[model samples]
Structures are given as structure tokens and as C-alpha cells.
Target: MSKLRVGVIGCGSIAQFRHLPEYAASQEVELVAVCDIVEDRVKEIANKYGAKAFTDYKELISSGEVDAVSVCTPNYLHAPISIEALNNGLHVLCEKPMATSQEEADAMIQAAQKNDKKLMIAHNQRFVRSHQLARQLIESGEIGKIYSFRTAFGHPGPEGWSVDGKDSWFFVKEKAYIGAMGDLGVHKTDLLRYLLGEEIVEVGAFIETTAKEFADVDDTAVCALKTESGIIGTLAASWSYTAKEDNSTIIYGEKAIIRLEDNPAYSLVVQYTNGETVNYELGKIQSNDEGGQQTTHVINHFVSAVVENKEPLITGEEGMKSLAVILAAIKSNETKTIAKVFE
Candidate 1:
């Protein structure tokens, strides 16, 4: 097979730092087109990657030269662009949270199914080597019957991080929807689900807009989750944390407790029931922060899935699962009760 021709939508921080660089670095992929609502940003990145530039993603997708496209646009545009690309016979790699609502997520999934094209969500946490190893340990019963866990993804606000700063669409309720829950919370929800190997069954959450000025979204959020297999846990996501903490997860079981962090070295730390403590630091695979190298991993997986006709670690359906948890958190915050997820 020839090199996969790729198009990138949204020339934002994520595209610049995560997907675009990885695509440019990938030997099996060709960065063919770049799109952004801001013409200058599109032009700049396209020139850097030596690709065609467009203000309209629709034009980029229809270029007929793209074998696969990465939907790096805002959360709101994820469903629409992914659906269009899939329908146009291009494989799609969309950013996280899948969609703001299940309806939109369902539509994206149906579009991929209808078009018979691959649709993957950029849930990079699943690609972390430590996360992969953690899953193996838990599944192998090395931890013995899992009972509970805690996970969090927190950092300072997006002002300096996002392209638009305080004016970024992320702070706008109309554009980004549910704030930190959608931004960081969804990642932890997905990570926990990946490690536990179970779908979330119920969620009770509290989401707040505590720190940022006029921020319509939650800066800090927390959720209690029950897994389909009866494991219970808590997940928290915050952009309001004063000191940065890369997203972290801790799992407790009959035999030991495991701690996993996605940075420095993606590592697993085990404190055994026998009073022995051991830390297995997994080597880093790519550049990553709180978002980790998962972005590069996800991009790599998307391209491989496109080329190999295989399923992605984070498929469109799996993306929806993570979104379901976030929506559950939102609903729980609203109703002040536990919301059932897959029920």
C-alpha cells in the first residue's frame, strides 16, 4: 500500500503539538492537507508541513487526495467533520469526548458504519505503555479482584495553552459545552474504563466553575462511578489546580494497590499486601504531558488501522463510551443523583 495521504482539521495547540508533528514524523503517512477557520493559521501549518491549506474542512476532505483525515477541530465540530470525512470515503481520527451528546456520537458512529470507514477517537491514554501494562496486570489477577480506584487529570486553565486564550471557544458554553469534564474529565473516565475493562454503569458527580473568570464551564469536576462488573471508583478532572498534576490513576485490589502516572516515565507502582513495594517504570514511547504521548500513539494507531484494515484501540464506539461517562457526570451534577450509564 502507498503512504496514507492525511488531512488535518484545526491548526490549534493539539494539532500543532500532538497530531501534526506525529503525522509529519510517521514514515507511512503523508501530510497532504491542513484546514482551520483562521486562514493564517492554516497557511502557516500547511507551509510547515508542505501541504495544501484550507479554511473549510469540507474542501480539504473532498480534495480526493486524502486517504485519512484527523478531525482536530473544536469539540463541537468533531461529529460533523468526522461524519463528512467518513461519508466521503476517508478514514477519520477525531479528538476526544467523541461528541457533546449521545445523539451526535450516535450519528458519527452510524456514519462510519454506513460508509464502511474507520472512525477513531483520539483517546491517547489507551496508547500509554503503562496503561497497557496496568490493564494486563489487573486482568491477570496480579492485583487480585479489583474493588476500587481513583483517577484525575488536572492542570492550570487553557488560556496560555489554547490558541484563543481566554477568548478560546473552550470557555464559551455554546461552543465547547461542558468545560473541564469534556476537556480533561473524559480522558480519566476513558482511562479508568480501559484499566478496569468494564463499562461504567452509574455515575454521581459534582461539576463546578470555580476559578476562571466568567468561565461557563466547570473548572473542577468529580464523579463517582460504578463499573459494569461491580467495581466502584472516583474520577476527578480540574483545570483549576494550582500545581500541575499529570493525569494519575490508582487502583486497589485484594493483593495490592497500583499507581500509574503518564509522564516522566509512564510507570506502574505496586504496593503489595505482603508489605513489599515495587515500581516498574515503563519507558516513554513519545512526547507527552498530562495529555501524554497518547496523541502520537493514537495518530499512529489511526494510520495503522487505516492501512491494515484493523480496529483501533479507541474506536468511535469506545469514544462514545467515554463521552457517556462525561455526560453522566454532567447529568449527575444537574440532578444531584447517580445517573445510570449503559442502562
Candidate 2:
């Protein structure tokens, strides 16, 4: 069996922690190239993965050795790099919130369609065991009609996560586009959409810069969303947290309420109207090479999908769907009006 050759763009924290390691661990993948604007970082990653290094992403995309590429770059670069790789006849696994704007996301989709290559997004929360179980429960109608919900993702800050800390692109609006909303909020947004199997039609948001002195972007954000099915919910994401909390969701239903959390053990807890509560331990949730290793699980899923010639658990369209909500939230914050997602 031939290994799938992969070129990874952006040797940043995400690429180093989540993607590069996962690609290395994949039985069906061979890391063929690593690219980054920072030459030293790319060289280091390439050496670590035993792959060719390039400062120019175009070189990696044009390199005939690569069958796929992971666009693990800053938020602004996600669409352009992914589209380029797809147009180059290579499969793409792009990091979320898909792109900086809906227009960019549309272009990426079009590029994938034009190239006839698979495009997946790194919304790894969809692959988490507890989250998946929650989706199954909702789909089974075991929770009855969901009335309202809340999803939140919080981390201390990206300073510790990045090699450059406050100097990282995360603090720059040009690179990150949006702050917590784009980085952490999009994860919960995607998870909520996936678990509920619903579309967020409208969103009202409030954004704040609570901490991190040099950061001009939002450090925290809160948004209220209305699903197409009339289900209402709140999504909160923050980098101002003193203590970290992984992704969490609470679903309220007629018969029961479901609660899922990422820490203190990845599990789902259900509370029934009759006052009976059931606890389910989902063991380990899929993660990256970062704190929880969630990215590893997500990357494995992408590789598996390619090797099996099947669609990934989170397709590019699904990623775009999640991005739609995030973009709507940003718009809502800007206009101080509830922005309709599909518009």
C-alpha cells in the first residue's frame, strides 16, 4: 500500500502540535514537505518529520511528491492556501473558521469543485467521543425537542500556545481576522451545529478585549443564536480565562437535558425531567498534539477518509457551514443587529 504524501503549510503551533505529529503517526500518510513563511521553523519541522522544507507555500503545493496538503496557517491564509492546493490537484485539510469571510469560503468551495479534490476542515470537535455520543442521542430523539442550548470554549491565552506568545499572529487582526470568536468560538459553533444537525440562521453578538495588552483583537465574545428550527442558544468563547476549560455544551430538551464537558474526564451527563440523571464516560475525546491531543484524532480522521476514498467526518461544506455562524456573529457584533447567517 502506498502512503499518502502530505505537505503541511505553516509550521506554527497548530501544525507542529496537531497536524505534523498526527501525519507522522498515520499509517497511511508520509510527510512529504513542510512550508512556512518563517524559514527556520519550516526547516525545523521538515527535519523533524523527515520531509523537504520550503519557505514558499507555492513550492510545496507545486511539489509533485505531495498528494495532499494541510493548510494550518493563520485564519486569513486558510482559504487562499487551501484553494491553491486543491487547484494543484492535491487534497486539502484546512484549519477553521474556514476563512476570514464568507466570500473567501465560497471561493475555496468553488476551487475544490473545479479541481474535483476533497477539502476538509479541522473542526476536530466533531470527532470527539462525547460530542459524537451527544449527537447520537439527539438524533435518536432520546432527548426530545431541544429548546435552548449553550456552548463555550475557553483557554488562558494563545501566548502560551504559540512560540512567540504576544508577538504571535494571534494578537494581530490582520493575521487572525477575529480573536476568540474565530479561534475558539468557531469550534463550539461547529460542534453545536453538528450535534444538533441544525443551521444557525441568525446571530446577535457582543465582543470584548478583556486582557492581553498588545492584543487588539477580541479576547472574549458572547453570541446568541437562533437555529432554523427555532431552537435558541448561546455560544461563548474566551482567551481571557484564568483557568482553561475545553469545549462544553448544554442542550435543554422537553424530556431531558444533556451536558457535555471536556475536562475532569470527557463525558456526557443527562438530567431528566423526572429528576433522574445518567452519566456517560466517553473515555478520551479526540484532540490535537496540544494540551488534549484532539488534533491527532481529527488528523487521523482526514487521513482515514483519504485512504478509504470516503468523505471526512467534517467535510469542507460542513466547515463552511460552521464558518457561516462565526461570520454572522462577527457581523452581528459590528452592526449591533442580529445578522442572518444565510444572508
Candidate 3:
């Protein structure tokens, strides 16, 4: 099989750390081109990867050097770039939140449908081994009838992660659209849907920018969410975790309680009401800490889907559903009331 020609559109931390390296490692992919508004960054990545570099994404998309592209730009540029790439006949692996609004998400979905291209969102949390095990246990009825849950994703903020550090686009409201909710909350929203096999139907949120001094976007957010089946939960996303990061989820069910990433020795643990216990020794979830290891399953999945002419697990529609929950949460924060999802 001929290798799929791949292009990366952003030279930021995510692209450098995840997309580009993964693409280079994949024998099924050829790093054919790269684009970024920053000429130096794009040129450096291009030289290292032996691909052409372009300052204009439009030029790269129209250059016909790539069959697929990874949209790793800022949140605001995600929709337009992915849609444009799809319209230009390139399969897209877009970095999440998906879009700033439901309208943009819908447009991206429509573009992919219209062009008959695959559009996958990079929701990497679903690819974690622990998360997969949790989903399997839930589906197998090991955890009977989930009742409530609490999931949180927090860290010491993006300044430590982004390539631009404190001045990163992540803190800019115009570029980021939403802060903690968009950057971290959307991952949980997608993960919850993937793990529970249920859609978030409503949300009530409290959002604030209490920690970061320069950020116009919220540095912390807590959302109360209800699934379609009436399962309620609190999802928290924060950038104020200065001392320690928390990427934990606890699910309460009639049969057992399943905890994920709550312990260092065991990544998943289930304690049953019948006095039985099960411990899963899956490896730790990826963190922003230096030297932390994370599987590149999302990149592999996207490439495999493109090479085999199959749909990705996180399709455009699936991504849009996840985005809807976050959008609802934002609305809930704005109006100080519960907001209906996908309304």
C-alpha cells in the first residue's frame, strides 16, 4: 500500500510533541508538507522532517503534496482550516474542542460529508488503556446501572505546556474561544461519552478566571452534567492546580464503584457492594509534567483509518456531540441556569 502523504498545519507544542513525531514514526505515512504562520517554526519542522514548508495554510492545502492533514492550530482556526482542508479533498485530523460554537462544528461536519473525506477529532483521552478498560467493564454489566460520577482534568496551567509559554494563544480569548473548559473540559466530555456510551443532555456551569493573571479566559470551571439516561455528574476543569494535577474520575454504580487514575499503583480500581474488589494495573494517564509518557494511539488510529479507508472512532459527528456539551456549559455559565445540549 502506498503511504498516505501527510501535512501538519501547526508548529506548536501539540504538533511538535504529538502529531509530527507520530507521523514520522508511522510507516504508512509520508511527511510531505508542513505549514505555520510562523516562518521559523514551520521551516524548522519542515527541515527536520524533510518536507516542504509554507507560511500560508491555503498554499499548503492547494499544493497537492499531501493527501491528509492535521489541523493543530488555535481553537478559533480549527473549524475554518479543517473545513477548508476537507473542501480541498484532504482528510483532516483536527485537534479538539472541535469548534467554538455548534454552528462551526456543524459546518465542519457538513464540509466533510460534502467532500466525502474523513474528519477525526484528536480526543486522546479515549485512547488511554485505563479508559478503555473502564468502558469495557461498564458495557459488560460489571458495573450495574451507573448512578453518578465526578471527573476532573486539571494542571498547573498551559504556560508550562504551550510552546509560547505564558504568552500562548491558549490564554487569548479571541484565539482560544474558551479557556479551561475548551482546553480541558471538552476532553472529559468526550471521554465520558465514550466510556458511558451516553450523551450529555444538559449542563449547569460555574466558570471563572481566578488564577491566571494575564488570561482573559476562565482559568477554572466546574460543570454539572446530566446524561441522556439521567445519570448526573460533576465535571471540573482547571488551570489552578499548582501543587499537583488531578485527572481522576469516579463512577458510582449499583453494583460497584469504579475509580480511574485515583491511585498511583493502580490506574483503575473497582470496589463492589458485594464485598468483592478488582484492581487493574493499567499504566498511568499522560500528564503535562516533564518526561511524562503518553501513547500516540490517536495518531495511529487516524492514520489507520485513512490508509484502510475506514471511519475513525471519533468522527466529525462524534466530535460535534462532545463539543455541544461544552458549548452548553458555556451557555449555562453565561445565563446562570441549566442549558440544554444540542438544542
Candidate 4:
């Protein structure tokens, strides 16, 4: 089969570190075009990848130079760009938090269904080797029934990771919508659901802008969540962990306690109630702070889904469900009460 031509929208940090490199590395993909509002950044990326650069996403989408696109833009543009690309009969791999609202997310799903195009969301947490193994263990009843979990994703902040640093769109409400919750929290929400095989049903949260100067959005958020299967847990997302990142999850089960990314060297560790222990060294989990040559398994999965004509592991509907949890948490914070997740 011919290589799948690809265009990437937004030549930002994620595009630079994850999308572009992964797509370029894939034998099934041809990086044909790139779009970003910043001319210099777009030019640099396009030149590096030997692709055309555009300042406008619409032009890139309509140029007919690619078969699929990776939307790495701000949260607000995710839905519109993805819907447009799907309407134009192009498969879309969108960055997370699918959209700022459920309505936008629904519209995106509708567009993909209407156009019969694949719409995959970049919830990279689901692709982590440790996370995949955790799901397997849980499914195989090795952990028995999961009773609770505590998952956190905290870092120094996006300023250090985004192309524009502190002045990036991540700090702006109109562009980003939600801060740490959308940026980091939604990832854990998705992963927990994937690992537990349950949908988050309710949320109680305290989301505040306690840190990060000049940022109008929340810099810290702690959510109390309950899944459909009666599992309860705490989900914390923060940009205030200036000392170091804390991207870890601990699952409490009937038979054992499963720890993920808790220890520096071990990716997963299980402590059984019978005083038995199992350690797994599945390498490090990829992080925005520690930018390295790590395989997220996102770009390759997207490319394969398109090439092999299979549904992506993280589909539009699944993405929307995860987005709903964050949205519900946001509402929980605003109302100072438990919020029910939208179905």
C-alpha cells in the first residue's frame, strides 16, 4: 500500500516532540504538510520534515496534500478543526480534552460519523506500556476487584513545555478553557477508566488557581470520582508541583495494591495481601516535562488504524466520555457540589 500522506496542525511543543517525530518515524506515513499561526515555527518544522507550511489550518486542510491530520492546536480549536477535517473526508487524530464542551465533542463525533472518517483522540496515557499491563492484570483478575484508586498527574507547568513558554495559549481561558484539569487531569481520568473498564459517574472537585503567576485558569485541581461500578478514587491534576512531577497511580484491590510509575526505576509494582510482591520495569512513562525519545504509541496507532481500516483504540466517543468527566469535575468545582457526568 502507498504511504499515508499526513498534515499536522499546530507546530507547538507537542507537535515538535511527539506528533511530527512519530509520524516521520512511521513507514506508513508521509509528513506532507504542517500548519501553525507562527510562521517561523511552522517553517522550521515544515523544512525539517520536508513538507509545506501554512499559517492557516483551513488552507492546509483544504490543500488536498494529505490523507490525514493531527490536530495539536489549543483546546478550543480541537473540535472545529477535527469536524472540518472529518467533513473534508480526512481522518483526524486530535489532541486531548477533545473539546471544551460536550456539545462540541458531540458535534465532532457526528461529523466523523456523517463523513465516515476515523476520529482518534491523542489520549497517550492509554498507550503507556505500564498502563496496558495494568489493564491486563485487572482484566485477568490478578488484582481481584478494584476498590479504589488515586491517580495524579502534576508537573512544573506548561510554560516550560509550550513553544511560547509562559506566554503560551495554555494560560489563556478563551483558548484553553480549563487549566490543569484539561491539560493534565483528563489524561488520568481516561487512563483510570481504561484500566478499570468503568465509566466515571460522578465528580466532586476543588479546582483553583493557587499557583502559576499571570495564569487566569486553575493551576491545581483535586477531584473525588466514583465510577459506574462503585469504585471511588481521587484524581489530582496540578501545575504547582514545581519540585518535580508526580505522575503516578495507586490501585487498591481486594487481593493486592497496584502501583504505577510510583518508583523511579520500576514502572509497576504489585503488593499482594498474602505478602507477595511483583515488580515490573516497563521503562518510564512519557511526560511533557521530561521531553525524551519515548514512544507514545499514539501516532503509530493512528496511522495503523487509518491504513488497516480498523477503529482506533481511542475513538471520538471514548474521548468524549473522558472529556465529560473533566467537564463534570469543572462543574463540581463551580457548584461546590458533586456533579453527575453527562452520558
Candidate 5:
């Protein structure tokens, strides 16, 4: 098959460090165009990669210069750009939080289905080796009958990682939609659901803008989630882990307790009910503060799916289900009540 020509919209941090570089590295992909409001950013990236540069995403989409595009724009633009690309007969690997609302997410999914194009969400947590291994152990009854779990994804905040730092769109309410919940929370929400292989049916949460007083969005959020199988868990998303980043999960089961990325020394550790223990060093989990790039596997997976005419692991529907948990948590926070997911 011919190389899949690709364009990337949004020259932000994720685009600069993840999408653009990954596409450039993929032999099966041709990095054909780049779009961002910041003209200089796109020009530099385009020149470096020998791709067309555009300030307007609409122009990039209609330029007939690419077969697919990565929607790495801010949260608000995710659904719109992806829908436009899908409708224009191009595949889309959209960045996470996928959309600010379920209505928009639904539209994106519909557009891809109607156009017969691929729409993959960039939820990279599921691609981590430790996470994949953890899921397998649970499925194989290594950790029999998962009873509960606690997962968290936290860091100092987007200020250090964002291209514009303190004044970046990440801290803007209108552009970002939600802060930590959408930024970090949705990842754990998606990861937990994937590992448990269950749909989160209900949620109640306490979300607050405790840190980053300059920001209007929530900086800390704690959610109580209950799955369809009656398994319950807690999820914490925060931008206030001042000292260090914490991206880990602990699952309790009848047979054993599985720990993922919780220990710096070990990627995954299993403790059995019979006082037996096992440890595995899978690989490193991607980090924003590491000042280095780890192949997220998200780009590779999406590219292969599009090229092979196969369904991706995290499709629009799967993205929506994950986003629903956060959306429900938001609703629950406002109403001070438990919210039923997918209602």
C-alpha cells in the first residue's frame, strides 16, 4: 500500500513533541502538512519535515495534500476538526478528551461512520505495556474477580509542559473546557475501564479549582466510580502533585492485588492472597515532565489501523464511553449527587 499522507492540526506541545515527530518517524506515513494559528511554529515544523504549512486548519483539510490528519488542537476544537476531516474523506487520530460534550462526540462518531473513515481517539494509556499486562493478568484470573481499584494521574500542571506556559490555552476555560479532569482524569477513566473490561455505569465526584489560582478550570478532582459488574473504584486527577508526577493504579481482587506503575523500581507487582508475590518490569510509561519522548504507541496503532483497513482499539465509541465518566463526574459535582453514566 502507498504511504498514508498525513497532516497534523495544532502545533502545540503535543503536536510538537508527539504527533509530528511520530508521523515523521513512521515509514508507512508521509508527513505532508501542518496547521496552527502560530504561523512561525507551523513553518518551522513544516520546513523541518518538508511538509506544507498552514495557519488555518480548514485550508489544510481542503488542500488535497493529505489522506489523514491528527487533531491535536485544544479540547474545544477536537470534535469539530475531526468531524470535518472525517467528512472530507480523511482518517483522523484525534487527541483525547475527544470532545467537550457528549453531543459533539456523538457527531464526530457519526461523521466517521457516515464517511466510512477511521476516527481514532488518542488515549495512549491503554497502549502502555504494564497496563496491557495488568489487564491480561486480570482476564486470565491471575488476579481473580477484581473487587475494587484506585487510579490517579497527576502532575505539577500544564504550565511547565505547555508551549505557552502560564498563559497557554490549557488554563483558559472556554478553550480547555475542563482542567485536570479532562487533561489527566479522562486518561485514568479510560484506563480503568479498559483494564477491568467493564463500563463505568455511575459516578459521584468532588471537583475543585484548588491549585493554579490563576486558572479558572478545576485543578483537582476525585471521583467515585461503579462499574456494570458492581465493581467500584476511586479516580484522582490533579495538577497539584507539586513534588512529582503520580500516574499509577492499584487493583484489588479475590486472588491478588495488582499494582501498576506505583513503584519506581517495578512497573507491575502482583501480591497474592496466599502471601505469594511476583514482579515484572514491563517498560516505562510515557511522562510529560521527563523532558524526553516515549513512543506512545498511539500514533503507530492509529496508522496501522488506517493502512490495514482495520478497526482501531480506541474508536470514537470507546472514547465517548471514557469521556462520559468525566462528564458524569462534572454533573455530579455540580448537583452534589451521584450521576448515572450513559443515561
Candidate 6:
């Protein structure tokens, strides 16, 4: 079978570390082009992979050298690049927080639908082995009814992860639109929805700009969220975890409690009401730390979806649902009240 030619429309940390590398390693896709506003960065990445480089994403999209694209750009550019790619008749694999707002997300979805192309969001949490297993356990009634959950995705900020370091657009309110909440919080929102197989209906949050002096956006956010099924939970996101990363999730269920990415020895642990305990060595969740899981399941899954001519596991509409929850949380923080997620 002829491989799908892919262009990654951002040479940032995510593209360098996850999307580009994963595309090169895939058997079903070819890394054919790369784009970034920084010419040097794009050229460097493209040279490394023997792919074409473009400073402007629009040029790359119109180059017609790629069958698909990975929108690894910053928060604000997600919708624009993705919608452009979809309208150009290319499948899109966009990074998390698919858009800065619900309207943009809706536009991206509409573009994909109008073009009859697949648009997958890179919510890698749903692809984590422990998360997948946890979803299965919950679906099979192993954990019984879930009462609550607390899932956090905290790290030492984008300075440590982005290629541009502290100067990354993640610290800019204009470019990023939101801080850690948009960067990390959206992942947990999507994860919780996936694991519970329900939509987050409401969110209340306390978002603050207390950590980085260089950032104009909130560096920390703690939110209270409720699923459509009446499950309540807390979601925390921070760029102030200066020492280390904390990516953990704990779900409280009636028959058993499911703990994910909490223990280094075991990625998942479950304790039953009958005093039975099961530990699963599903491996650590993906992180920027050295020796962490090297490959992201996002690129592979996207390739498979395009190759099989099927919709991805996380569609633009699903991504829009997750983004709606985050937007509600932001609204809740601004208004100091619970905000219902817009359907």
C-alpha cells in the first residue's frame, strides 16, 4: 500500500519530540514536509528528516505534497491550520485544546465534514495503556459506578519542553490565549470524558497567574467538574510544578477504586471493596522527562484512521466537547460561579 504523505505544521517541542518522530517511525505514513514561522527551525527539522520545509503554513498546505497534516502549532493556531488543511482535502491530526474557543472548534469540525476528511485531536491520554485499561474496566463494570475523580497534568512549564524555551508562545496570553489550563488541563478534561464515557456538563474553577513572572497567562488552575452522569471530580493544571511532573489520576468507584499513573512501579492500581488489589504495569504516562515513553500513540492512530478510511477515536466534535468544558472552566473562573458546558 502507498504510504500517506504527512506534513507537520509546527516545529515546536511537540512536533520535534512527538509528531514528527512518530511519523517517521510509522510504516503507513511518510514525513514529507514541515512548517514553522521560524525558518531556521523548519529547515532544521526538515533537513533532519529529508523533508521539505516552509516558513508559512499556508504555503505548505497549498504545496500539495502531503495527504495529511499534524497541527502542532500553538493554542490559537490550532483551528486555523486544521480547518485550512481539512478544506484543502487533507486529514488533520491536531494537538490538544483543538481551538481557543468553541466557535473555532466548530469551524474546524465543519470544515472537516464539508471536505469529508478525518480530523483527529492529539489527546494522547486516551491512548495511554493505563487509561485504555481503566476505560475498559469501567465499561465492563469492574469498577462499578464511579463517584468522583481527580486527574492532574502538571509540569515545570513549557520552558522545559518547548524548543523556544521560556520564550515559547505558551507564556503569551495573546498567542496561547490560556496558560496551563489550555496546555494541560484540556488533556485531563478529555481523558475524564473518555474514561467515564460521558461528557463534562459543568465546570467551576480558580485560575491564577501566580507562578511565572514572564507569563501573562494563568500558570495554575484548579477546577471542579461534573460529568453528565453525575460524577463529580477535580482537575488541576499547573506550569509551576518547578521540581518535577505530576501526571496522575484517581477514580473512586463503588466496587473498586482505580488509580492511574500514581505509582512508578505500576502505572495502574485497583483496590476492590472485598480487599482485593490488582496492580497493572501498564507503563508510565508520556512525559517530557528523559527516558519517558518515547512514542506517542496519537500519530500512529491518526495514520491508521486515514489509512483505513475511518473516523478517528477522537473526532473534531469530541474535541469540541472537551474544549467546551475548558472554556466553561475559564468562564467559571472569570465569573466566580459554576458554568454549564455549552452543548
TM-score of 4: 0.98
Superposition error at 146 for model 6 (Å): 1.2
* Selected candidate, larger lDDT, 3 vs 5: 5
Write down the lDDT of every candidate, Cα atoms only: 0.85, 0.85, 0.93, 0.93, 0.94, 0.90
TM-score of each: 0.95, 0.96, 0.98, 0.98, 0.99, 0.97
Residue 324: error of model 5 in Å? 0.5
Q: Please report, as a residue range, the 10-residue window in candidate 2 with the lowest summed lDDT.
A: 286-295
Lowest summed lDDT across 10 adjacent residues in model 4 is found at 286-295
Model 3, global lDDT = 0.93
Give per-residue lDDT, candidate 6, residue 48. Answer: 99
Kindly report which residue stretches of model 5 are placed more than 4 angstroms away from their true locations once superposed: none
Q: How many residue pairs clash (N, CA or C atoms closer than 3 angstroms) in each of the candidate models, in the order given?
A: 1, 8, 0, 0, 0, 0
For residue 61, model 3's alpha carbon misses the true position, in angstroms, by 0.1
lDDT of 3 by residue, 1-343 (tens): 7889999999999998889988998889999999999999888989999999999999999998899999999999999999899999999999999899989999999999999999999999898899999999999998999999999999999898889999999999999999999999999999999989999999999999999989999999999999999999999999998988899999999999999999889999999999988899987787777544465688999999988889999999999999999999999999999999988
> Can you write out model 2's per-residue Cα lDDT over 51-77, one digit (the tens) per residue?
999999898898798999999888888
Evaluated at residue 216, the lDDT of candidate 2 is 85
**Predicted structure 5: lDDT:** 0.94
lDDT of 5 by residue, 153-179 (tens): 999999999999999898999999999
lDDT of 1: 0.85
Q: How does candidate 6 score on lDDT?
A: 0.90
How far does residue 110 in candidate 6 sit from its true spot (Å)?
A: 0.5
Q: Single out the weakest 10-residue window by summed lDDT for candidate 6.
A: 288-297
Give per-residue CA lDDT, model 4, range 1-343, as digits (tens).
Answer: 7899999999888888899999999988999999999898889888999999999999989998889999999999999999999999999999998999999999999999999899999999988899999999999999999999999999989998888999999999999999999999999999999999989999999999988879989999999999998899999999999988999999999999999999998999999999999999988898765674687999999999999999999999999999999999989989899999994
Off by over 4 Å in 4: none
